[model samples]
Target: MSSAGEAPSELTGAFIEIAKVTDLGATGESETVVGNTTADVSISKDQTNSETNKHSQRRSVRTKTYNTLDIEVPALLVPGASQLETMGVVDSDGEEIYGDVWDACRIHIYDKEPATASSPAQTFEFENVEWDWSEISLPEDYGEISFTGWVHGAWRRGKTATS
Candidate 1:
């Protein structure tokens, strides 16, 4: 019998596509994130020029649902990296300001370079995202769209070469 290992296929993996860093404007103000998918949207018009413009839109998305069990996995993280820290909105005195997500919410992370102990560093931006998932799986069981966090460990290794 053959060994119990499945051969690798090029189709199975998660990769980062859009990478950029940007400020969330001034505190208290809101920003919008448009993705490659479109289910809902906002429209703005320039009356002076009589032109229609797309304001805020919920484009296409691949949403995932998770419950308490998934959270316990520990390795599963939104946006997929453990290095991402959560920063909440604070007031002028640095007091925490709580906000509500009436609809879906936008997500943001600070820009940082990918680094290893002795490897060369590469600069990259965190993703600022907006998404909704009321249609994916269950309603109350849905979770945040995992951005680019689920990186696999064996990614750097390849099949051994033979003559």
Candidate 2:
């Protein structure tokens, strides 16, 4: 188990991947395969805190607001590429075209260097996920694209690696 003042194992060589819920067969069952194409991945859970003060006493409560997932991958040039295409965008006629906008998907993060045995991986199931925004940067070395989305409803299952 984890406790305060202990630093968990760092996710140095972790990876992230996403798959459309519809990709699953009629039974809606599939295995999570982490993508190696993505260069970076970030996941965060945000909450709204409300504090009540009553006559020199203070009370506070926290409510889960939403979760956000950001993925950065190399811009694909091939037609109907795998990673970018699955993210609701496809290369059409030498132009980027939007594909299915509203689709449910699952995002998986696998921590290769877990702090403990229990912190192996985490999965977040998002419903009604749509493309929020993306950015392309032209640097001296190479070009990269980042995609961000707002998860309507998210369910997370995992355990933090403990010391």
Per-candidate TM-score against the hidden true structure: 0.17, 0.47
The collision pairs in model 1 are 37-59, 37-60, 38-59, 38-60, 79-147, 79-148, 79-149, 80-149, 80-150, 81-149
On residues 1-163, what C-alpha lDDT tens digit does candidate 1 reach at each position? Answer: 0132321221111211122123422333333332211111121111122333355645543333321100001111233112122212223454433421112122122122223123212212112222222222211222233221221111112211222
lDDT of each residue in 95-117, candidate 2, tens digit only: 45543444455555566633332
Name the best candidate (by TM-score). Answer: 2
Candidate 1 lDDT trough over 10 residues, lowest sum: 67-76
Root-mean-square deviation of every model: 19.5, 8.5
Instruction: Give the Cα error of residue 19 in candidate 1, in Å.
Output: 11
Residue pairs with backbone atoms closer than 3 Å in model 2 (clashes): none
RMSD of 2: 8.5
TM-score of 2: 0.47
Q: Whose lDDT is greatest here?
A: 2
- lDDT of every model, 2 decimals: 0.22, 0.42
Candidate 1 TM-score, true structure as reference: 0.17
Q: Where is model 2 poorest over a 10-residue stretch in terms of lDDT?
A: 1-10
